[model samples]
Target: MSLLPDSAVTSAPGLRRAQLLLARQALEAILAAQRPADAILQDLFRDNRQCGSRDRARISELVYGVLRDLRRLQAIAGVQADAGALCALRLLDQGLADAATLEAWGLTASTALARRLAGFDPATLTPAQRDNLPQACHERLVAQYGEDATAALAQALRGQAQVDLRVNRLKATREAARQRLAQEGVKAEPTPRSPLGLRLSARAPLQNLASFREGWVEPQDEGSQLIALLVGARPGDTVVDYCAGAGGKTLALAAQMQDRGELLACDISAARLKKLRPRLQRAGVNSVVGLALPDETALAKFAGRCDAVLVDAPCSATGTWRRNPELRLREPDFAALQALQLRILGDAARLPRAGGRLVYATCSLMAVENDEVVRAFLEQHPEYVREDAGEILRAAGADWQEPELRLLPQRHGTDGFYAVAFRRQGE
Candidate 1:
């Protein structure tokens, strides 16, 4: 397809045609390589420098909407739909496309295409098959968006996700941040249970907002904000943020300490820590002492000195599928995550002093990463005991949960997260 110049698509008719064409091309690339939807959209923006920001945003929304609801759309279309074909089907489903849209995209709503699609009975396909095709075809479909077969797919496809932000308490209160954003023509409502969270009804480009630029707010999920609250860093106490990648929660911890306590923020990646530097400055956080740990020797320096240790271990990020549905495409493999969690939990446990609290957190919905990891760690170290996270939050005047702080998109309107807290034996 020939790339059209922005000026050529200045008219309404021309813009709609360009959007359809771009959506088709982006879907084809996704199907061809199994690229993540976000990555595909980014590549589309990069490749089509002529496309304006509005055009890119519109195309991305349409593409992702179709990907999110491909299964249901295929059911409605009643055919074995490929990725490129799914884009057309979605346009039809949304009433965004008519006979003209297909033709404009250089596609003939051909009899042959219809016949091929009509041949397969979407009803006949097994639920799993409908959600995620066989492994052989999985890659192709995933390349085309076939991996979204989970039971939660329907929910994810039906709704538009809201923007969540955590108020930077170090810079401003949630009410103050809300007021600041309101003056800038953005609407925000406080999130329940998270003292520092605000939910945006409409998604706005936050970086352009004066409130965001002035460090009054930080883009963070409500569940993530709660995770930091669970850490409960107190003034004069020493805390450690193990696996503090880019220090999102680390800064929150610093804020909770009122910038009075010492916070040792440790991460394996120096590159990620470097990124946190600017954020620290923006949040006016000074209590955090950044530490790059290349190996265990680095972790050894501050062993048994921390009062509270937060191990936000890495996982498959199953919890964040609402924000990035592409993660559902990832193969459900616990082996690598299990190994990494073991190392992180072990290292994190060593960092806390006797009687210190250890909070293990993951943006993962899996049992293996949340409950099982904690169970295993407790078994190995008899001196540690699981604390009731829900009770702890309640005692802190925040309403949350223990057993499982699992936040499902359908249930909590937040990312799926699993957090558990533990306390060591008294000195």
Candidate 2:
């Protein structure tokens, strides 16, 4: 495993050892700096541009795998162990390396990690350890989904997320998009619940595909696509995507409108809203107008005028844990987040005209952020009435049939999302 040129072991196992060490170093930086794993990885790749594609992918997989199960790895590696021991423990537990191979790699240096993980019985570990969930998360899961379903949801989130794309029908139909992806060396199939959604067989370099660059496809989770569908924006109607960060749903709504309606994409961050212009242009979305928020006059103009309003409120983002495993390490301020969610709901709830629909959506699995917020908002604003979510899904041609829509990673193979639609009644 010598890295020095004079004693360099160029064998595959030696290279593998070197790579794992590097990954562990990066993981240490991620935890120490408290930075997003994806951002840190991007920076690492950017600085070491000489690394091949395979090397980058392998490194990313190793890093994310460890991050996903950091809690379990830590419990096994002991509180005294460093990041290197944690990585070693994860690789061994995953059976990525045999004891003999690990010994050659650095077993002496990682004795504590190896001893702890080897002696540790996975079944004896608590649910938090077995499922790599925070101990705090278990109680909340029970409160949200009861005991049985909570375990199921936790296990589902422990798996990797599927790569999903939204077919921009403005440029190509779902069938055409599927065919185009196939021709580009990427195999894809239509998502069962989203007519315009395509699930890739494996994650591929999307930017390299012609369909993506040509605006025929945009990478999006099926759950997110469903949230846009819940909005039910239509042609000749004015729609508002309040809090549309970078306007992913805004683009979808424009396509649903056949690019024939007024669609305002608003966000508090000007920097994020600025990104929407290029995406809108690329998607051939002609009906979207991006607006930075806190502009009293701007928001007032759309008040009580939109046929549809989508409040894609911010939350803990626990639903996206599969894709962003780093978030699993942080604790959420539930009280502050819920208060903010209610304020945003109240603000966005004003845009829907009488008889018009306002959809509240969150990429969160927590009931406090989804149902509780909706209930509070409904109580405050009696002018709005909740709509049948399953009825809307059926009308949108989705095969789903539940009174409420809660797409989970394990259940639906999509990012966890909770959406409830309501039509503002005339007072």
Candidate 3:
């Protein structure tokens, strides 16, 4: 029984105002607090259990819309931009609100706000400003990908990400899943890069769909689907999904193995892993053995035994900015994150046996966390040799053909992902 305010708020206009007020409260709390955006929303909705679906969606959109375009809205509205001002700028920019409506939303009217955004052109602003990217990170991208591509990525990431899903091969084929969605009056198309990936053109209440509830499909980005495919786990093989948060790739790998392999999903946080349990059951996956580590017993149980180990190491999550712009609000300590990546890499490498594969992956666009980490790891461990990541993908029939696997959001229509593989040569 939820007590969240329902949509019965007087009239349509009043409903909008109520939702906007909720959004403002949520935004302020999210910005000031260190907790993740999703957690804040969960708590907010839990307390306001009577908030209807429409109210929830509207409130969420306002919160995310402002967070995504936070910098641009602040610039347009000047330094005095609060949630009201930011919301007004966004609504006006999207043509959802006029000056009067902006005032109605509790934003003070200013000629500067109107003038700055009138007939706005992205090309007029500098690349970083235009793309709304952090300047230091933008500079790093410029150094690696050059100015043009970096700008393109920023623009691409600023757009709303398309909904992508992985057709669970264990329960349904891609063709069958597509047919099911079509039967339900949902439009979907196969993703370009991943054979198992489906792209949804419009948002649908997926949880209500029989296909999703039956685990015929699981929502996953094409980039993430590709990473799971790249793991290349086979039946009867011992595989490790190191740092498996929520076990998205774990479920995919279990299906890849036809549920016949020893698949250990390892993570430092048991709570995150706990959430993976029901999803695994829904997907009918039975092969994955969850192991929370730095537990010496668990580490010893799997040490030097895995045929393939996926070090999906923690990162800045720069690649996922399209869906999660809240990342831009805070700066993670790169030095500390890098040190942790190194330690995790060393620990994960210990799980792969001689001649086994080590696939290091991150959903990050930064060269510091992507290539630099791999470079440092290789220098420290001479026994391990770099494997041709692109060739491995090609062998699996992916169209990627570079020396390493670096999929850019702008070019690949997928989140920016970096993956490099290594093999311990003993065979």
Candidate 4:
């Protein structure tokens, strides 16, 4: 599993240079591939086993810092700045490095670059660059949320995300899980909203913890936990997670149903569905049936039979920018994404029986992918009536009260999420 050979692992003397070098390489790969920074760095660290804890800490900070404020760094460093240059600029801005440090890393700090970085003004930045968003994404946000709201959302997205966990009710109560995690030196407090959620004060090696290993808790966003709660699936009901990639929501739904319902987890990718098997076993869930789609005849059999259906459709993931900053650099094709979302909603709509509930949700802030998609679906399927998501969630103990539930990182301290529930008109 190690990516690097034995020769590359260095002792303490060259550790600083090694860390910088690794950070540069990792950042370059992330920028070029436009992949998740977390995944890319996991691969990089795996290859270089010689990297100590400190080395990994430094590397991750540099890589994520550069990505979090990339456009501004690009403005000061250069539009085509290399990873090394960006890293140097980031260090300089944070007061983590100086001229000598850059020189030691074989990098140059021009007077202009230094001046611009030190005296950088928000007034000087273009709206897009100020928001750290690609031009297309900026324009889209402005069109959907207006300039002022978009800027606030952008500011929220630039901040870091806290780790949240959803206690597996099947395995333990929230208080019991908290106590067990604390015994293992992990500090967490109950989340403000979701009854089953906990917010960790800092990241810990949760995978090695007995609580996680035994599935007493699973990492999930509070907003995501709220979405599962909104589904309102009960024991003995038949529910379907229509686009269940890796079964996060499916698992949560099973817990909601008290592991006594018929829960169908369906996804187009069999490989993705395969991942849910181990998770299901670990969570001690027995009600789930994983299905890989394109089995039209098979899925059709469930039509008008399920009590509830959840369409956590794929989207541009703009609401998740706080955790996945790399997405800010890429331009998503909104037209195509909209069309696909609408189509998926239509397909999922058929699964809920008459008078059954359907909740369409996305981790997206864009109207085209959130409200627009749902409204479009309503226009096509008049038999489905939109319900107040806030009312449903409030009865379940959430503070929200809007017609459609929109969770924003800035306002709610959670990932940006949108959910709208609907009920079939006839019984």
Candidate 5:
């Protein structure tokens, strides 16, 4: 096949090819063991110094897109379809691949494989089987594209997610950030619930952007911003951001307090806390006192002193699957994560003084991680009562409402998040 001119390619074809290769490598790494896709992508980009920005973007997109739809694609192609073959099928479905492209890459498009897909009927597959299919198949195309057995195998594939940023209110307003971003050729709109949130129309290289460099905005999901908002850290309040990795929400809390509160940001990781220092400085957040805890014993020093504590606990980040689609591939292990959740909750709860509020938040969609964890914590500490998360947000001046403060991408155009606010019964 003749090589098309630069204009004929939707994206750079050369970059696409590099991305496809890296994506296959990433899949192989995942099959080897559980690893975060973002970390893997960063390592890949770092190793291949020759790869440019466009190549990195294309590779990351292809890798994540395939991961998100791996099961549906596998079911369509047949259960035993390996990662490489499945990725090829996804490219074909997206019209990014053709016979000539495969041939040019020295890949032989097996006639048997093509024939099997040609005769597949997706209508016959069960819902479970369909869900088990690869991530590349679309719901609408289930009938036409997955004819033969492929149609029955096609499941709903999650679409591309927008990049969200939380405007550093300590440095700039949401409107001001939007205007600044516009000057940099980045289009963004205000998020519904977050006073300082903006959702970018498309993912752009932000590392070099002036707004980011100036710390006017921080890359954070809208749902995440809402979690910090639920904390209700008013000026002069003493607050602790437990497990404040890199101080994303901690910084947000500092902003909300208008730099008048004493915000102690504590994390187990010294390295992560060190990184926050520069960011805190750039955001002009002077109220946050970064503390690197050696262990639980170190956290106990601040026990019963904080007026509010925000525990953005660690969990399987299932709610963020849209941005990092590879999360759908994780095998759910409720028992292990539940135990860790209990530990974090108990530890974080210790920091709050009597009558103080504690906001439990997770980027997990699973009830086991969110509601169950909160329920168990409440059971252990009868002194604490569940404050209505919705009520807290309303009091904070949040317009977009929900009963449980749960945010789902399909419903709210944000990452899946679950937050619960609690207050101690009496001082």
Candidate 6:
């Protein structure tokens, strides 16, 4: 593909070409579906030890920018969707650079191509292309939220996500954690929704901060914090995080229990359970008991015992598109995912005793993964009745109007999340 005119194809010097080459390599690897964009970039940086922080930053910016706006960039760049042209088009489209400066970055595009990009019209592309989402994703979102709202949601996800942290209440109060982060040169403000959450204005090396290393805070989205809150696991209550992958919610629930009650963190992977050991110690939590279940059937041991059971079932993770844009490019089997979600929710529901709270949640925007799964599980389990999630969240200091907790990026300034609280009936 001839994206560059003869005049624009000059030999750019060493550093510029190297940056462009690295960016292209990362983008190609991501598009090839080998691994996540972030992982690919990590490998690239590790292999090229000479790349400084600034070089890594530039390469990452280009790679993510292209992924976030792949379909739109493809529409603008036409058939010549090579890495150089797409990067050049993305830069120009973002007003980051002009056509004249493109050659300096070792990105070249023909004058006509540049002109077409400058006057690119969204009307010329299909709705899916305009939204830069896969056709199936766009259709599902549109079916649920209508066209205009889906467009807004898609656009919201195209931007970068803020770095939010959940202050580990066992270690320190939110205010104390904020003060500690400030001392480490990281600025943060309280999130609008989550009472114990802090939102960073920009990305920071949080792992290096003394507060983070001391377990004063954990990197969690504000929406995720709210999900934990919805569980309403109080002191001395037996709570179970039924699908604790890395134990993020398990730690939060443990803190809510004030290190008093029995908090069981269950997952199918022992490897993932192992990762939570140090985090539990760092947060000074003592109530959590990490359990690796052989499968969903293993939950039978806790049947009709716990006061609260949280099923954070895995799905397509569509709500995390802002952080993982590649999700928008790939299509997941919604039917299969919904089946798995229902199976897990049903298995977990048995753990909650009569009148106990059972909460189901997912980091997904699709109804099949969220509302549909909840509806299916409730239909099969007559003892469980859906409760108003908004009421629970409101009582916990976060005001939500809907019956369920639907945290959207376009509205909530956090990652997408859907949660519904249920109550078991009868003895």
TM-score of each: 0.85, 0.93, 0.91, 0.93, 0.86, 0.90
Model 2 scores a C-alpha lDDT of 0.83
Q: For candidate 5, what is the total of clashing residue pairs?
A: 22
Best by lDDT: 4
Off by over 4 Å in 2: 1-18, 98-108
Off by over 4 Å in 4: 1-15, 109-112, 119-122
Summarize candidate 2's per-residue lDDT along 21-83 as a digit string, tens digits.
668778888888867888898888788676667667767888898888887777776665577
Residue-level lDDT of model 3, residues 55-99, one tens digit each, is 788788888888877877777776768767777677667765566
lDDT per residue (tens digit) for residues 317-378 in model 4: 98898899988787888999999999999998999999899999999888889888887999
lDDT string for model 5 (1-427, tens) is 2122345445325435545667778777765657778888788778887777666766776777677666657766675477666667677666666645644554455334455656778776665345543332233224433444333222222566678999987778889999999999999999888777899988788997989989899998888888898999999999999889978898889888988978989888989999998988888888888787756665677788888999888887766666666665646566888898898889788778889999888887667788788889989999899888777887877765665688766667777788888998875
What TM-score quantifies how close candidate 2 is to the native fold?
A: 0.93
Model 1 alpha-carbon drift over 4 Å, by segment: 1-15, 28-36, 71-83, 108-122, 129-158, 401-403
Model 1 TM-score on a 0 to 1 scale: 0.85
**Model 1 agreement with the true structure over 237-297: per-residue lDDT tens digits:** 8998988997989988888898897898888888888899888888888888888876667
Which of 2 and 3 is ahead in TM-score? 2
- In every candidate, how many clashes are there? 4, 0, 5, 2, 22, 0
Residue-level error in angstroms, candidate 2, position 133: 1.4
Order of candidates by lDDT, top first?
4, 6, 2, 3, 5, 1
Q: Residue 346 of model 3: what lDDT? A: 91
* lDDT of prediction 1: 0.73
